[model samples]
Target: MMDAALQALKQYFGYDRFRTGQDQIISRILNGQDTVGIMPTGGGKSLCYQIPALLFPGVTLVISPLISLMKDQVDALKDVGIQATFINSSLTFSETNERLSAAAQGIYKLVYIAPERLEVSGFVRILEHMHVSLVAIDEAHCISQWGHDFRPSYRAIPAMIDRFARRPAVVALTATATPRVTTDIRKLFGIEAEGVVATGFARDNLNFQVVRGQSADVFLLDYLRKNRDQPGIVYAATRKEVDRLYARLTQQGLAVGRYHAGLSEKERAASQEQFLYDDLTVLVATNAFGMGINKSNVRFVIHYNMPRNIEAYYQEAGRAGRDGEKSDCILLFAPQDIRLQKFFIDQSDMDETLKQAEYHKLEQMIGYCHTETCLQAYILRYFGERNPSGCGHCGNCLDTREKTDVTVNAQKVLSCVKRLRERYGKIMVAKVLAGASEQKLRSLHLDRLPTYGIMKEQTQKQIGEFIDFLTAEQYLVQQGGAYPVLALAERSLPVLKGEARVLKKGHIRAERLAVDDALFEVLKQVRKTLAQKEFVPPYIIFSDQSLREMSARLPATDHDFLMIKGVGQQKLEKYGHAFMQAIAGYQAEQKNAVN
Candidate 1:
């Protein structure tokens, strides 16, 4: 059975190996176990059910939330010569019935449906008649109210499964699920702990970065100008920001598009198509843009503001480098971003408890932005996965450092808090230390204290940075209340007594790589020509990774081309000759030039 599954993987998807947790999940499902797969974004979770669908005796019913994802997956599957179809609100009533009738007759091997369809009486009646062999739920975290994106529609899944004449093995999959959300999913599906397979969240190919104290507009313009031709997504927090960024980028004459809920359905679809088809090099969007998008070549995902929580940020940022190539995930953060997120929490319809949970998650996200530790390690730890620190590729680890011993500065700050009775927030503390002439300071007599103005050499921004760092490192803790106050922790005793040292790194920027423009251009031409001939997305034929590999390897024959990662038996048979011919021609041209 395992061998058959492997055969299906190679034959259909063109992959020679299973990613970390895919094989076990596939094996467990084939062995007749109902499972929950908690893999990271880009971890190949779809293959868990996809491969089994090929082996199952009847059809696989896939419940997905997004219409775009359904169309994208169905197209990709059909491109690989797999029989698949989708039934969604986009179809006319007659069209839906036609597809449902075909599915009942086993004309399609896999059927994709929106979760809302499961609640429809007519759709449920049709599903009961279909010979369903498997029920695979994508974005399974939507079922958990504790999750960042919860949908009440997902609650209808288990009941829908019960209506099936022959109960199929259930596999629930999600890219983002906290421990609490994971338990909820398991309990909802009645799956035991051993039946759950969570392959940990870590994307080594992504370079995570957080830059503060810079104008986001200026920084974004500079960065985009440098990598003008590469594919990227700039995520803003609101539709207004999306529109603003879109207008600015468009004014600069870049191939960019904008997506938000505000756009009409036709406009949103057109914008998405433009990006997916490589007509747009950049997409400026709110969180609404990326849920089920499978565009594989996005080289960067920049957050114009911090998201409300780590789960949302990680999922959004993980969209980059889905093809397992080097990509950038940058967050341009400002303190006001937190205020904006807090405003969202205040306006949300969630209950008080859920709102409190969101606030706690927000604080963790703020600590991540300010922490001096390795960025990757911080994210992995947040997801309950422990790994060794100092992943050498993150912004902090790759930064050229001049570590200043801030032990004395930390002691001064902690002592000032004590002298002031720990009644103030960070700004107040900085004001007292920077010796500001504010009336509040004078009225409170804080200006008369000996500790005041001791660190006047430091700028207000510098003081705030140090304070945020101290709070993150636990030398200073923030008390919880309507107006939280900064209080010294037990660890501060060591720093105050000169027993512990604190270090701060002055980070120098790293150099960017110069792309192989000539070869990259040639490959794009070939991909465009091929995509035009086939009328499919270019990445579907050969991902950006495949093209990059081809350019680097200069494969001159069919055999050599097959060795590339995404090239499989099916793809090799269909498109190998053309790519190999292009590579051979390019190599010959280079040789002639050298001669």
Candidate 2:
């Protein structure tokens, strides 16, 4: 069975070996044991069930959270020569029934359905008649209320599975699930605590970066100009910022698109399609974009503003380099971004407990922006990975800027926070430190403190940023929800007692992804033309990774073409001639030019 799985993997998906933990998950599912797979994005979670789906006697039901996800996965599955179909809100009633009837006839090896469909007795009744050998739950974290993106619809999944006369072996998979969310999912699904297969949450192919204290717009424009041909997503916190960035990039004549909830469905879908088809090189969107997006050529993901939490940031940023190529995850952060996130938390309808959780997450995100350690390690640590090693390519690890001893400056900030009774936030402390004669400060007599005006040489903005750095470094901690007060942490005692030193690095700048070869460009054009003819995204034809492989190997024969990593029998039969011909033509042209 394992050998068959391996053969199916290469014959259909074009991969010879399973990614780490993928084989384990697939073996468990094949053995009729329920499993939980916690792999990072582009970690081949889909293939765990997909390969099993091909080998199983009955159809594999994939319960996804989004309609777009369903469409994307189903389309990719079909391209891989697998019989797959999706039943979702996008389909008409008759169309849904037609697909369901097809599934009943065993026409599809995999059926992708939204979770909400399970709630409908009519749908459940239709599914009951089909032979379901496996049930794969994508984005399984949605079932946990503790997760960043929770959907109540996911809670209906276990019950839906129980309704079947013969319960299918269940597998839950997600790219971003913290230990808490993972535990919650295990409990709900009755998965054994030791049964979880986590491949760790580290994305070694992604270079993590956090850019602070710079003009975001200026830096973005500069960075875009450098990597103009690269496909990337710039995520803003709000629709307004998305619109602003979109307009600015458009005015600069960049091929960019925007996606947000504010746009009409048609507009959003059109923009998303344009992005997926590679008509646009950059997409400026809010968090609403890129969930379950299967496009594999994205080279970078930039955060125009700080995200509310690390999980949201990681998931959004993970969208880059899905093809397993090196990519950048850049965060452009500002102090106001924190306040803006806080404002959102304050205005949310969540109970105090949830709101507090959000605040705590936000604090961690701020730490991410300010921490001088390896950025990738920080994220892994956040997700509960123990003592994960740092990727030496992130902004902090690569930062060669001069370090200045800021211990005295940190002491002054801590002293100010302590003198204020640990009740004031950054702005108030900055004001008092800068000797601002605001009515609030004068009314509270905060100006009379010994630490007041001690940092008069620095601007209020500088003091505020220094305070943020102190908080991130653990010398000061932000307490309270919404409007948090600055309090000295245990680490502050040593700094105040002149036993600890604080060193701050200079500003870090963005770097460009590696440039592609000329042959790779030619192959991309071939892919674009083929995709246009087939009415599919270019990646649906061949990923950037595959194209690069082709360009490097310069395959000339059918046998050689099939040896390319992503080339399966179906893809070879369907697209072999065109790509092989293109490669031969390029070789001939190079020969002629040399002659």
Candidate 3:
């Protein structure tokens, strides 16, 4: 056992030590125990199984839902001189038969198969008879119905897991899962022994920020214009959105590719191959992109639309900054996001109970958006981890919000909703409050309500903003049923009936995140000094993330310089001198420290 394990680690993987959670999970599997790993993206999840495949006597079966993911993994393993192969519908009949034959003969260290393909003929029989050392399930959360990305084929895993009595220890991997989703995975795998390592949902290396109240096209255009040549993903909520943006971006001369559910399998496969090969600078895709992707140089992930749940959001956003460099996760939000998501949910065949649960999850996400609590901390807490107050890396922590006395404003909105009898939607209520004398509104007799036109003090836009704020504060609840109606939340009564006074509301502006003047000036100074000193392009000396890091936490010493993202040994040796000098100068002048 010791010799095989040593040979496997040293000869196959070419590594000296195991990543933080890899060894422990592998040991559990080697000891014949089931293991479930709830690791973050770029957390060295594949190593856990790759190493075990070499150590154990039999073939390691990796059940993946994504053909592209399996192909990427197999190619990566092959690149590093390890024996790995995959069987899926993408391959021809002869190719599948050949791989299965090799698997039956115990010739390959690891064999990957799609979950859908496993339910077909000649699969269960081979899995049942082959010397299956272990079974690893990647993206295991897809099996649960509660997840936004669900598949009926994932339900086939347990039947396959049940086929082997002395089942190779089951090991599951997923980048994102809520407390409920995690519990569901534990139940499905029926693993008595599990390795549940939840790295903090917070990514200190990545700056998480958002720009709300803009059309996706405009927001995406601005982002691309700024980060012109960077590696990133532009995530859309639908296929049509993806195609629309893809065409526009291509026309704008950006080296872009598109991926979505509507694309033919061949088109998606080609697009994915090009992306993995780095032929495409950016992939404008629906949420369907980036599952089990192994690329490490992705510098940014821009969500063109709001994600359905924080789990999906964190998982998708976590794709960035994998190499421990500075990365950015930017969300472009519009209040219309909820309506879009709600419309999609309404089309699903889920029961009322399930649909309601999903809707509330979205509501909780909206509450998160309007929160003053740091975005990273809120995300961590929602995933069952306790994070300290503010992360200082998110939009809320980095920007200042003006506190306003909104007591009178709150009262006016509540009175308007009640006076309107909670019968109309936001548009009608907004029109009445803004004193808009429109034809449809007049026909409904809302033009003569007692509170109608009483709120002429606030404009149409201001009233809509205030209504969103009130909804977020829980003073107003969006009535949920066939068509969404508006009414006051339970907490509104106390504020209206004089039980509590009003509180301050905070707002975030886009231009600040789009450009940080303090940081921009510092970057200019650094670039001027560095360019003169080293005679290289300023951008080459320090990338955008490095500059942002310099601004956020000014690193003076050489040790601290290494801590600044993207500075490898080569960069630190070549360009480290200039940054340290400026940092020293900046530190000398500050009566207050950078922290």
Best by TM-score: 2
What stretches of model 1 exceed 4 Å from their correct place?
A: 403-517
Off by over 4 Å in 3: 1-16, 146-150, 193-200, 213-218, 247-253, 387-389, 401-595
Error of 1 at 480 (Å): 17
RMSD of each: 4.7, 4.2, 8.5
The CA lDDT of each predicted structure is 0.87, 0.89, 0.74
Clashes of each: 0, 0, 0
Error at 253, model 1, angstroms = 2.9
Predicted candidate 3 versus true structure: per-residue lDDT over 1-595, tens digit per residue: 5345545664444344565676777777778778888777867788778877887887999988877677667865654457889988889988988988988898898999888876675678777888888888888889887776777888888888788857677888887777787778888878653356555555777778766533446667777777765678889888888898899999999889999988998898778766655567699998878984766657789888888778888889988876566678888776556778888878989999889988988877776666766888888888788655788878778776666777876887788899888887777788988889899878988788777876798788778877766765567767765566689888888888878767753544333123434544566566646545653324334545566676777777667766765554555665567776766666676746644
User: Candidate 3 — what's its lDDT?
Assistant: 0.74
Which residue pairs come into collision in candidate 3?
A: none
Give the range where candidate 1 is weakest over 10 consecutive residues by summed lDDT: 505-514
**What is the lDDT for 128 in model 2?**
87
Worst 10 residues of 3 by lDDT: 508-517
The sequence of per-residue lDDT tens digits that candidate 1 reaches over residues 1-595 is 9999988887777678898999999999998899999888778888899999999988999999999889889988888888999989899999998998888888899999999987788778888888888999999999999999999999999999998878999999998888899999999999999999988787888999987644567778888888888888999999999999999999999999999999998999898988888888999999989886888888899999899999999999999988888888999876667767888999999999999999999999999988878999998888877675678998878777677887888988999999989999989999888988899899999999988998999987789877876775568777754567889999899788888898866533423533655776788878878887887778878888888888888777767877787777778888888888877788789899999
> Estimated TM-score per prediction?
0.84, 0.87, 0.72
Instruction: Give the winner by lDDT.
Output: 2
Better of 1 and 3 by lDDT: 1
lDDT of 2 by residue, 1-595 (tens): 9999999998997888888999999999999999999999998888999999999998999999888878888888888778999988888999988988989999999999999988888888888899999999999999998899999999999998898999999999998999999999999999998789999998889998887755577789999988999999999999998999999999999999999999999999999999999999999999989995888889999999999999999999999998899999999876667778988989988899999999999989888987879999999999999998878899888878898897887888888888999988889999999988788888888878998899888899888777766764567767776687888899889888999898877656555687759999999999999999988899989999999899988888888888898889999999999999999999999999999
